[model samples]
Target: MTTNRLWRTLSGFNLSTRKWTQVNPRKARSQVPSNLLSLTSWNIDAFSPRAIARAKLILDHVLHESKPPDIIFLQEVTTAVRASLLQDAGVRGGYLVTDAEDQTAFENVPFATMTLLSRARFAFGSDSTEASEDDEVDGEGDLMIGRVSRMSLPSKYGRDALCVDLIKPAATGTSFRLINVHLDSLGHTLHYRAQQLEILANVLRESGCGGGIIAGDFNAISPEDEGLIDMNQLQDAWTALHGETGVEGATWGVGAKRRDGLGPGRLDKVAILGSKAEAMDVLRPGSIEVPRPGQESIFLPWSDHCGLSCSFTF
Candidate 1:
């Protein structure tokens, strides 16, 4: 698609090209087993050192979950924060990490990037071993680095989607693609988000993968918004497991001292396409508190937006 067409679409203009395009519907390629896979997605709010430090604490805590996530998708991660996460002992042992930033955009816009971390190997038919306490003795595990790619979006802030493919063996012996995205944060209008979603949908369509997981800070208050409707192929994990309701899931602005003139809303999400996503009993929609470094009595949210974790069977 041309840049002008993309801009026009984002501006609420419908393209006749989309109607004429005879794209075949993607079919299910593999049936994933009942093996429960934990996935986590979060917006770290890494605009400052304090926020990055808090994100680190949250990452450390998340790594220690009873059934730790096998894969993680993160957004709003700056270069410094990514470096810190790479060096953190919590992630050093078994995680393979990759990140992508919008190089096409200016450098002063905070340059937030999307990141993916996986414990699975990157080769198909490889032995997939879960990391254990004993595995830490070696300082690293057998997790192979996955293939990573970036798809730039039509945004002034250099927004982009980072995708990683984990090709390790599973009960069903199939590879899985994990996409991490951060849509236009400044654009609240439905048309603006629709344009970004169109770009993302095009990427997914071209990927040709049967099914995979997509998670990020969408910055959309409601999933039913028109912009998000274009992504009908993907199923929202929250709504798939729990039927839609009026009550807001509210992942954003939950535990902040300042609301930033924004009330509680569900912006962060984990959605699945061509796979079944089941919410584990341990999955709870809420905020995690992070205490100040020197002041134990003072506690704040790990991020302006709370971390979201869910378990998927596929």
Candidate 2:
């Protein structure tokens, strides 16, 4: 894509293109191995009982899919709940991490185990501090504007998001990190989300990996959405690979219901750090509209929110 086109598509370019684009360019060839690594991130809204059952149904669909995600990130879930579910599923998930935000105390719970599950060798990333104040969660009357209203950055509501760095086992090892985030939703504050993104960026910078994938319910709309991330520094895997328009694409819902339709709403995101991975691309909706076998509809109602997954070769 031309520089102008790329800029228009991404819509956010705080830093000059000359300075940022130089960090990394799209690789001539894909870094992905013959065997692709797939991952899924969903906000299960596990706090709700009905949603929990839906999550189970979604998990069942995922496990049945032909090529299940090698790594998965599930949000809004309690650690205890995940433990019991994993036991029931008979699948052992490693590198499990949960959030310790104070809001977790409301139900007498300390933290929600927003889990990062994987079948590969997983390394955990450090957690960001949780938000302590009440106004932080309840955005200061700036919903439509989507910009930060105050000076304080809302700590992740007692539920620190989780990130997992995964490495391929080989004589010449290749590693990448996966950051799963669930930003504040009650308040559509882009500035707050931007701060969270900054934290995640720092995590990737510290990972020492050449590049990594950041995925989650970002809670912000796409660049197309007036109030959203600029995303110029990051490369969107799905949009890059999926060509620009499709329905089964968007990961969010519209109107009264949380997941009301099939329309595309790119609220959920999977962004690849330009400095790290090469030839990043979307894998699940690879080639055709239908999901790869063993992974079909694995995302359905798993959480109130939809799932975001991607694969990048290092």
Candidate 3:
């Protein structure tokens, strides 16, 4: 939890600009296993009603999935949610967290942002003394992190992609990136979200990994948002498995209480730019019982936006 050592059992970070610019203090291991890589994306709505209890429920639901996802993406992560995630046993034991608290690395000005939980682990270089203080590796060579960094995106609400380099060193000698992002939310058209999507796609394209995922709250309220996939050279998991108009694929306004008078919308999404998709569904943590001052109990959805879950080979 110290400011200097992230990925060291949830502890340092560096500022990455475009690509994998950070020196590979620890070389990537062999190519990723030919197994289905699971992913989940959600905007937890940290600014709304009961954030603390919802944070706990969110943690319990994701970590205990019937088949837990390899990578989990969460948006609307307030300081309280981040702190709870850090203190949780499942997060500390199962995933390597990003340093959202550090301004030098990731932007901390956003009222709510994104956090990535990855189960990918890496191997260090031959020399034991190769790691410097800033290197986010453990004493042993099995480093659970390749590198944790972020890149700024154009948003009126201060949005950025929380990029994590998964050390699946392919035979071609290029590792892939798993980026978590919460794109701009104001525009009714794809104007703002389109710009953000392009930037995320650019990062994947520049990496030459050909196989990275940009999953989070895309705020894809517009119909044209689907075309952005072709525009950005990426594949959408929703369309791949469930098709365009599958009611089951809807994430937002589904399992939650919506008073906006809006019908169920698939706002949260997972777009890949994958091995292949095996299964896909929405995370419906029906409701939580909140103890009131004198009343018996009240039920509420964990988030205003239901989380999206997808599984594909890597």
What's the lDDT for all of these models? 0.54, 0.44, 0.63
Global Cα lDDT for candidate 1: 0.54
Model 2 lDDT tens row, 203-271: 556534545667777766534332233444666666667756554566655222444333446667777
Candidate 1 segments whose C-alpha is farther than 4 A from its true place: 2-36, 100-109, 120-146, 168-175, 187-189, 222-231, 246-248, 255-261, 280-298
**TM-score of predicted structure 3:** 0.77
Residue 132, candidate 3: alpha-carbon lDDT? 26
Q: Score candidate 2 by TM-score against the native.
A: 0.58
* Ranking of all candidate structures by their lDDT, best first: 3, 1, 2
lDDT of 3 by residue, 1-314 (tens): 11122231223133343221223333333234534466777788776567878877887888887655667788887776676666677765555456534434334564455454443444333322232224345333233344555676666777767776554322233446678888877446468788888877777766445467888888877678768877887888888887877557777777445476666777877777645667778777657777888888888788878888887766
Candidate 3 stretches greater than 4 Å from native: 1-35, 100-110, 114-144, 170-172, 255-259, 291-297
Model 1 TM-score on a 0 to 1 scale: 0.68
Clashing pairs in 1: none
Relative to the unseen true structure, what is the Cα RMSD of model 1? 12.8
What is candidate 3's CA lDDT for residue 238? 80
